[model samples]
Target chain A: MIQDIVTVFIKEFKEILQMRGTKRSGWINILVVIGVMGVYMPLMSGREWVTNLLNPISFAWLPFFLVIGVVADSFAGERERHTLETLLASRLPDASILLGKIAAGVVYSLGIGITSLLIGGVVANLGSLEEGFVYYPLDFLGILWALSLLLALLMASLGTLVSLRASSVRQASQTLSLSMLVFWVGIFLVTRFLPEEARVLLSGFFTPERLPMFVAMVVLGLVVADAVLISVAMLRFKRSRLILD
Target chain B: MNDVIVTQSLTRDFKTVRAVDHLTFQVPYGTVFGFLGPNGAGKTTTIRLLLGLLEPTGGTAHVLGFNSQSEGHRIREQTGALLEHPGLYERLSALDNLDFYGRVYHLPAIQRRSRIQELLEHLGLWERRHEPLAGWSRGMKQKVAIARALLHRPKLIFLDEPTAGLDPVAAVELRNDLAQLAEAEKVTVFLTTHNLSEAERLCGLVAIIRAGKLVAFGSPETLRSRRKNERVEIYGQGLEQSLLPWLDTHFGVRQAGLVNGHLELEWPGDRELSSLVRALVERGVGVEEVRRNKASLEEVFLDLVVDGDKEPYTA
Candidate 1:
């Protein structure tokens, strides 16, 4: 089973790399994102990028959004291009296919996220020549890695579920983007309209002394959501239903 | 011969429609079995059910002695299919497409490489294997898809309309290649096709379905011979106006007419050619040539479908 999943993962990752019609174009797209997030942002921010405590948290959400770009194509794109049925007909188990797709999305997003972070650290150091070499603290680096991976898994799970039901890749992408928009807007509205006492209590919970607890809660929530979404996706991944869809 | 596939009262329903209704048949080993039907006649659905991709609503199917629903993975592991569409990845190269499936089937590196090469070279696509399939014509893409299906050397292969939309030359080419491959590999083939001529040429046994029901099932020779309307054509001068009325009046003749320069007669089962020829010569129609004709598979298929429309469902 592990070998089968790895085979699917290899094919999916290769497809992701060749998604832009050519390897050169695909690499260029990846480079553009890396250039902006890794080089430009860190260069302009300089030492602040490393010293700022919130930098890791902000960067963790980067993979959350980045995974959405490619995960929408995970199943919907195969169905749209008439390849899903053949894949389903193969000997590979359903679990392998599902996990391979999720793995592809997670790996692509997390790889980019980590690479950008590393490049940002280097750029921060290079740009801060007068201040000498600088890097993110070890504890913060660990938080960045964990949060980025959890967030990527969260998005990958959500995106794959949507892609499975969507009639086309365009529909899947639009639905995912709209869902994210609605979620963020709803959170913003709820927070803004919260009672003053509740707002203060929430703010108190995020104090530096309690920051680790807050991150832990967030990670727990993502983990729970990922598990539930993945479970539902697996339940719905019947060959009969997918073929009809 | 061993029965590679056996389905008893197998059925499939989609919402309000019964796509395949109580389909029961057996496909023997090492033989080409044609599932012949018109559009929307449940051919594809039957293939899907037999392949274990879709579960039957009614009875059961056993492929290679394994229950389709319970042992679907085992069935798929040993069987290959080219479904309703070519199902090739257009963005990938032809070689990549076959190689991907080879890996999925877990062919070792050396065997996979050689199998891909053998299939592609045989199908005349080896030279263009590295080029992306997106730029190829539909025929070329279909060839690559066929190669992909055969790369694993499955014991049983389901091909859904392998030549559905090809032009004459390309269709014949694909048909020839498919025949050679199936024969050389000694594989049991469950082929679904609307083309009666193709079925006649390739299949040893055929089952025709209409409105999700099996209307007829037998070898091509048996189906063709089942229709009792034997035709006879007599070609010569003075065969049109003078013979038309006389031929029409005869009791053995079901219908008679001038086709091109020949006198054509549809003979009932009890009729004899000698009696017809003696009557034709006596009528002063010079009989230069006379030949007996059996119903073509197309005629039998149309007859069966028409007959099926008039009768209640019984398979």
Candidate 2:
């Protein structure tokens, strides 16, 4: 089973790289993202980037979007190209294919996210020469890494669920984007409409003394969401149902 | 001979419609078995069922000695299929396409490389192996798909309409290649095609289905011989249409007609050819040549389908 998943993972990664017609083009796109997120943004922010917790929080959203872009095409692209049926007819088990796709999306997004943060550190140090060899604090860096990975997994799981029902890659991407938008809007509305006492309680939880607990809660919530989404996606990835679709 | 596939009263239903109704047959190992059917006659459905991609609503199918419903993975592990579509990754190179399937089937590195080379060269696509299939022609893409299916060297293979939309030259080229490859590999081929000529030329056995029901199953010759009428044509200069009425009245003659200055008669059973010739000669008709013609598979297929249409579904 592990070997089968690895086989599918290798194929999916190759496909993601070749999606833009050539491997070179795909690398160029990744480089562009790194340049903007790692070099440009950190260079502009300079000394404040290492000192501010909000800066890392802003960067955590990068993997969410990156994962959405890749995961949207996981199953839907295969169906569009008429390759899904062939893949499903193979000896691969259902769990292996699903897990392999999820792994590919998570790895791609996480790799980009980590690389960007490391390059950001280099750029911040180089741009702020007076503040020689500056870096993100160890604890903050840990939180950033963990949160970004969780967010990437969360988006990938949601995207896979949407891709399962979508007939085309375009439709999957559009549906994922809309659902993400709705999710953020719902969160915003809930926070804004919360009672005064509830708002006070939320603020109290995010205070400096309780900030670690707040972060833990958020990560825990994302993990649960990821698990539920992944389970639903796996259940829907039936060979008999997919062939008819 | 060992049988690679056996289905007993295999049935599948899609909601209100029965896609396959009690389809019972056996495909002997190492033979090209053609499942001939018209459009919407459940050819694709049966292929899916045999591959265990879809389960039968009733009855059972055993492929390569594994129960399709219970041991689908084991069956798929030992069999390959080229479905209704080419199912090739157009963005990937032809070599990559075959290599992917090779890895999926767990071919060793050395064997995978050699097998890809052998199949690609055999299909005459070795030179363009590195080029992406997006730029290749439909025939070329199809060849790559076939190579992918054969990459695993499975004991059985299912091909659904392998040459459905190809030009005459491409179709004939594919048919020839398929015949040669099947023989060389000595693999059982379960091919579904509506092309009767292809079936007659390539298949050792065939089953014709209409409306999700098997109408006829036999060798092409056996099916063609199902019609008991033996047709004989007498090409003569003085063959007149007035003799058609007299010829029709004969007890042995089921039908008679004049075609291209030849008197064509359908004799029901074994009859004396000399007697018919003598009668024609006596009727002031010149007996130039006599030829017996057997019914083509196409005629047999059409007759069976028409007959099937007249009968209502029992269940």
Candidate 3:
């Protein structure tokens, strides 16, 4: 099963790398994202970027969004291209295929996030040459990696479920995009319309002294959501149903 | 297993429509078994059922001695399929496409490489294998797909309408390549096609289906010989359309028509041809040449498909 997963992973990554018709274009897209988020943003943020506690927390969302762009194509793209039936006909176990797809999306998303962080570190040092080479605290780096991984897993799980039911890649993309839009709107509504007292209480709860607990709660919430979504997707992934789709 | 595949009253229904209805058949090992049907005749559905991609709504199917419903993966491990579509990743090169399936089947690297080479070279596509399949002609893509199916060298392979969209020359070329490869590999091929000539030329045994029902099953020769109507052609002018109704009403003459200035008649084989010619002469018909002909597989197929519900043809 491990070998099967790796095989599917390699195949999927190869396809993702050529999603733009050429490997060069695919690399360009990834590099562009890394440049904007990794280099430019860190350089503009100045020294506060490394010291600011909120920076890593906010950066975690990048992978969640990045995964959405490609994960929608996992199953839906194969169905649209008339390749799903043949794939289902192969000897590959269902779990391997599902995990491989999710792993591919997670790795791509987290890989970019990690690469950007490392690049951002360099950009931060280059900008702060007068202040001596500085870096993000080790604890913050660990938090960013963990948070990015969890978020990437959450979105990949959700995207795979959407892709499974979608008749085409366009439909899956629209559905995923709509969900993201809804999430953004929900956040905006909560942040902008919350009562003054509630906002105060929320800010107090997220203060540096209590930040670790807050992060732990978020991690716990994501772990539960990821488990539930992955389970549902697995349950829905029977070959008989998929072939009909 | 003596038979690579056996299905007993295998059935599938899509809501109100039955896609495969009570199909029962067995395919012996190492033979090209043709599943012939018109469009929407459930040929694809049956293949799906046999491959275990789609479960049967009723009855059962076993492939390679594994139950399709419970051991589909085991069956898939031992067989290959070229489904209704080529199913190649068009963005990838032909070599990449074959290589992907090789990995899916868990072929060792060295064996995978040699098998891909052997199939591509045999089909004359090795020279152009590095080019992406999206730019290739439909025929070329299909050849690559065939290579992918054969890469793992399974004991059985299912091919659905492989030459449906190809030009006549390409279709014939593909058909010839498929025949040679199937022979050389000694693989059991379950081929589905609407092309009667193709089926006749390649299949050792054939089954005909219509509206999800089995209409006929036998070799091309057996089906042709079993056709109830024996055809006779008489040439040399003066055979009028007016004589068709009389011939149709004759005791042994089933139907008659004037085609290309020749008199065409369908007679029961038990009837004597000499009496018919004498009667034609007496009727002022000039018979320059007379020929008795056996029905072609195409004619047999047409008869069974058109009047398929009459009775099932058994081997």
- Candidate with the greatest lDDT versus the true structure: 3
B28-125: candidate 3 lDDT, tens digit per residue: 99999999988899999998888888878999999999999888889999998899899999888888889888989888999989989889999999
Better of 1 and 2 by TM-score: 1
For model 3, state the Cα shift of residue A119 in Å: 0.7
lDDT of 2 at A176: 91
Assess every candidate by TM-score.
0.96, 0.94, 0.96
- Against the unseen true structure, what C-alpha lDDT does each candidate score? 0.87, 0.87, 0.89
Q: List the pairs of residues colliding in candidate 1.
A: none
Q: What docking class should model 2 receive?
A: medium
iRMS of each prediction: 0.8, 0.9, 0.8
| CA displacement after TM-score superposition, residue B208 of candidate 1 (Å) | 1.3
Ranking by TM-score: 3, 1, 2
Backbone clashes, each candidate: 0, 0, 0
TM-score of chain B of each: 0.94, 0.92, 0.96
| Clashing residue pairs for model 2 | none
lDDT of 1 at B236: 83
**Model 2, residue B41: what's the lDDT?**
92
Q: What share of the reference contacts survives in each candidate?
A: 0.73, 0.73, 0.84
Looking at candidate 3 chain B, the ten consecutive residues that score lowest on lDDT are B248-257
Q: Write the per-residue lDDT of candidate 1 for residues A1-245, one digit (tens) a residue.
A: 89888888888887888899987888898899889989999888878888885664578988899899889998999999999998888898999999999999999888888998888988877865887887888888997899899889999999999999999999999999999999999999998899999989888877889878888888799889889999999998999889989
**Model 1, span B13-79: residue lDDT tens:** 9889999999888888998999988899999888888878998889999999999988999999999
